[model samples]
Target: MPLFSNVPALRLTLAYAFHDPSSLLPHQTIPTLLSLPLPLGPSLPSLDGTGRKPTIRALVLDKDNTLCPPETAKLHQAYINKIEKVKECTEFSHSAHSILIVSNTAGSSPAPEHEAEAKQLELELGLPVLRQHPDRKKPFCGPDILKYFKDHGVTDNPREIVVVGDRLATDVLLAREMGSWSIWCRNGWRNPAMPGRDYRGFFSKTESRFERIMTRGFGNTAPLPKAT
Candidate 1:
């Protein structure tokens, strides 16, 4: 049986909810309209690069939630620790892959806040950051991310690349759209139901459940498929 038993029913209801001309909550319903499912295509093995193995030559990381904990609005000393963790966990050998940051921040019209954060991240992580507008159109990962890797001579093999982020709406969805794997860090942002004193709050079980539903329903539109 399919995981979402009521897929067709839900889709029909959502279609009526969104497209019915006389619907009362059109505005509220429109935002929930689902896109066509993106095919998972074929599976690629791990990018360790043995023989004809797929070459994953870049790692795109999200800043606020994936690498650095989100509680601190701006960069802080704790970021250094996160940077270290990224370096240690990611495959960053001189030959195979490079790491870059992809993120969004808010501020004035032009949003120098994201730029400043990128600069701080560069200093802390000792790597370049690729920033994109929050409202990136289709090809949601942004062209610059691809350009950054191209300019640096990074390989284009999807198996060799991975994107890590906290928000499925932005990071995971974007990565999946770009045909790259994604890792969702369960250490940032929390729904009210999972409130706690420290870092545990953001890593709530409720958030996990929601993410699971969204990810499964959305196919590869998630950061990391549920482990096996």
Candidate 2:
């Protein structure tokens, strides 16, 4: 993966995150997406206590680390039970399009190689994950994502979608850009081979460390969405 492939995204993230470090914070943080409260129909009242409620209608998930181990196209063994539990919920099982895995690697390009990765992930997870054009990568791809949700009958409102990922620069920043909710996976899947170990790589670990340092003292409150 090229470090500077998405210069625009990096620039946007740096500007907003530095201007308001809180923008880098997520509405919530969890070990994994499946750890979210089930049924997934309830409204998340604003933390600012203005009675603002954003009901989630769709989910935008990151593939690497957030789902499986970093760079893998399959689910972590430790997440298998969680996946089974999530499947029981009507929100996920209702429609294949309700949840999407928007990985920067697998599906964020027009290349056939990326398309193949997307297909493999969909097959492994039994979900309707799709590929994206190179310009449609996260943070820069927020509008394209919203359009996808609308086209798929998920929801036209950006506030109704939530982005879940392990990265602050990409995932959380993407949600902030979209005026949507976000959930940061503080700890990704546990390594099945090594119990009690986080499944991550050196690059991911270093990036996460940098993110923490950059967003220190920030409150984990999502930015309020614009009125429809």
Highest-scoring model, TM-score: 2
Residue 133 lDDT in candidate 1: 49
State the lDDT at 208 in candidate 1: 53
lDDT for each residue of candidate 1 in 1-228, tens digit (9 for 90 to 100): 111332442343345335531221100000010110111112233333333333445677665543545523354444455455545542454532377776655210156665666676676567776656444521254466766676777755554566655544445444554666655555453322433523423323344555455445543232222221
lDDT of 2 by residue, 12-52 (tens): 76687568767777777676665776655353546356565
Instruction: Flag regions of model 1 displaced more than 4 Å.
Output: 1-55, 71-79, 85-90, 95-97, 106-109, 133-139, 189-207, 213-228
The Cα RMSD of model 2 versus the native structure comes to 2.9
Highest-lDDT candidate: 2
After the best TM-score superposition of candidate 2, give how far the Cα of residue 175 lies from its true spot, in angstroms. 0.8
Please state the error at residue 74 of candidate 2 in Å. 2.7
Measured on C-alpha atoms, candidate 1 has an lDDT of 0.45
Task: List runs of model 2 lying over 4 Å from the truth.
Answer: 1-5, 41-43, 47-53, 192-220
